[model samples]
Target: MYEDFASTLAATMWTDFDETPEREGPTAEITDIDSFVIDGNFPWTIITLETDQGVTGIGEAYPSPGVHEIVTDYLRPVLVGENPLDVERLYNLMRESLSGRGSQWGVGTIAISGVEIALWDAAGKILDQPIYQLLGGKTRDEVRVYADCHAGEAMVSSAEEGQEETTYEPEAYARAARLAVEDGFDAVKFDLDVPSGRDIDTLSRHFDPPEIEHKRSVVEAVTEEVGDDAEVAVDLHWNFSPETAERLCEAIEPYDLAWVEDPLPPENTDAMRELKRSTNVTLLTGENRYGRHGFRDLIEEQAVDFLAPDVPKTGGIAETKKIADMAEAYYQALIPHNIGSPVATVATAHVGATVPNFVALEYHAREVPWWDDLVARDDPLIQNGRLTVPDGPGLGIELDWDVVDEHRKTRS
Candidate 1:
């Protein structure tokens, strides 16, 4: 068991900065990305787990400011000397061990998530096989993917570098969707919300009309181009109320949409179920969900037609698999929500490939050019819109330490 293997899990904080700018494709031109990322300071605190038998696993927590102290001060002690293989035991122990109530949903989940992921990585390393192979020996070889071509432009300079030129109009969006299909992707997801708001932080945003109109127009354009052959998804970023979402769904119902993602806030299953009951369009939610327990209410109640959980935020591999299984029991499709680094994408691909009931994975269509450089691999694992799982043990691909070191932000 992971609990008994003393050397199985160990954690260290690793930060990698973007050598290039991470762009927004069709979303808002909010100032938050600038306020936080102007200095090329994309700080992600990653944890590494090593086993007594000389195997290692890598996992990431929710990247945030001050993440180093949070990991070192709080999570490291709980994991430093524990067995990496005893995954379930450690998960339960850490759940009780963390401070404060409802810690499992916020930073607390993030802390334990890193530990759990590292353990999974270590287990794969120990078994000398890829992570998916260890997880019931991959049911499918390739994981289907959808291009999130919503990447507008890399924030290489400042947001004030003569203000961004709006190139991603409705025509441009449709063209991009076509190009994604040309490149072998069978599906694509585009955000139909205008990049409005002055203070567009992660959780808060002020509504604007021009932005919404622009977003709706963009969606209309993409729908015109892609037609029905491809699986097209639209993400609302939890901006609308149920009524607004319903109206939007009715407006776009003519497009034969594959799904409407995160139409309303994720926590409100009743609202989602209500919307689902009303809309002929497929309703989707669950990007902000945590664990299996967290998803149980949504699943049992039949909140939405699709379940999209992020890998890193939802307690890593094992917990995400469980969530998928639960979704399967309910006959809900599993479309993972991923919008981060390559490691997170690969981890998500593992789960998606092995699981029986899967829809598709999200990738920053515009971000590939920017994010591909971060990894050491030559060609990306993606081929023809399907990511071929790596053959090596653990997560398979290794981060370019030199590249990471060069772009590493000093914790000052």
Candidate 2:
């Protein structure tokens, strides 16, 4: 009896050790596209791709006007009957289709981002792997997150009366950074490029001495308040002309920013290349850029210190990774531009984990108190300025239907 029991135990050990779960092959066709417009301060255009095999995938595109129309009117017809697992092929086909409208840069790309992201989610689910696993596995267990703290009053509707207003004064900025630090975040970003203490014109590129001083003081206060506890970065929102941008970059150099983001608009790569040559300070941009092709010149020209692709805005998971791959070849850091809810944050993190030259990912949902509550997870999605890549299948977390049902917007 003892011999038989030992033999059985040994067999069980061998069975457990010798085999692992394998992903299912592509077999299901995409059946339908269901979407929602979660309108609040900013709209979240969420898409759900359904497969015939009872599997579904969730994805998000960055907030923009008329994304709903773009998705339903253009992309749905292309995706409905295709093999849900043919992610990259579908991505290319969509690009081809949109060539008539415009090249991959604006609302068309944003619409494709949502659809392509859903394909990855569907692929992950069909393969029984996390999105990161499908992307050739991750280099790290967690992706570092930076809080995108804003200074201006949020464009909240009158319905959101309970929501708080945020300001951009030196003291207020300091306090906001401290709050982020206390909440287990090691990095914080603030928008320092607002019409404050100055009036401006596009005809002439100039900033007043007091306005420049006010911006300088804002950075000083934040850096001082955070001290050695957390790193600081600031956004200029592509608000300045090249000449004015260089002056601002020089003025803010002493604060040791993680980056000074998008000082000039992304209209010209030659201009960005010139700006990079002028600053030893880490300059980052690319949230407005489309696919890998769109970012090619920026990387090849050594235009910026770091690349900041908004994964959901750029071209979804696969294209964003392709952009990072190019940036890695040039030895640059990738700080993904994130302004959506948890869906985009986690999707971007999956890509961040796979990239060799990733720096940090942005987290801009700080203003929405109930942002974390939208998804069902055992623990908080972000802690101590990093998010542990989820281990489950697909995006690894499901949208809480109850939460989405409460805040969904109705179109007239």
Lowest summed-lDDT stretch of 10 residues in model 2? 13-22
Give the clash count for model 2. Answer: 0
Q: Which stretches of candidate 2 lie over 4 Å from their true place?
A: 1-25, 154-166, 198-203
lDDT of each: 0.67, 0.81
lDDT of 1 by residue, 1-412 (tens): 3333312222221111101123442111101000011112234556665555655567766565544444455545555555555566666655655536334786668667766776667766765778888788788887888877653543212123454445555665676677777878778877665453334443443334454556667778877787775777887889887666777777778777788888887778888888988989987777788889889988999988888888877777778999999888889988888765677788888888689998788875243344666678899677888888787887787777666665555555
For residues 202-251, could you state the per-residue lDDT of candidate 2 as single tens digits? 44656767778889999999899999999999988888888888888888
Model 1 TM-score (2 dp): 0.80
TM-scores for candidates 1 onward, in order: 0.80, 0.89
Q: How many collisions between residues are there in candidate 1?
A: 13
Per-candidate clash tally: 13, 0
State the TM-score for model 2: 0.89
Which 10 residues in a row give candidate 1 its minimum summed lDDT?
29-38
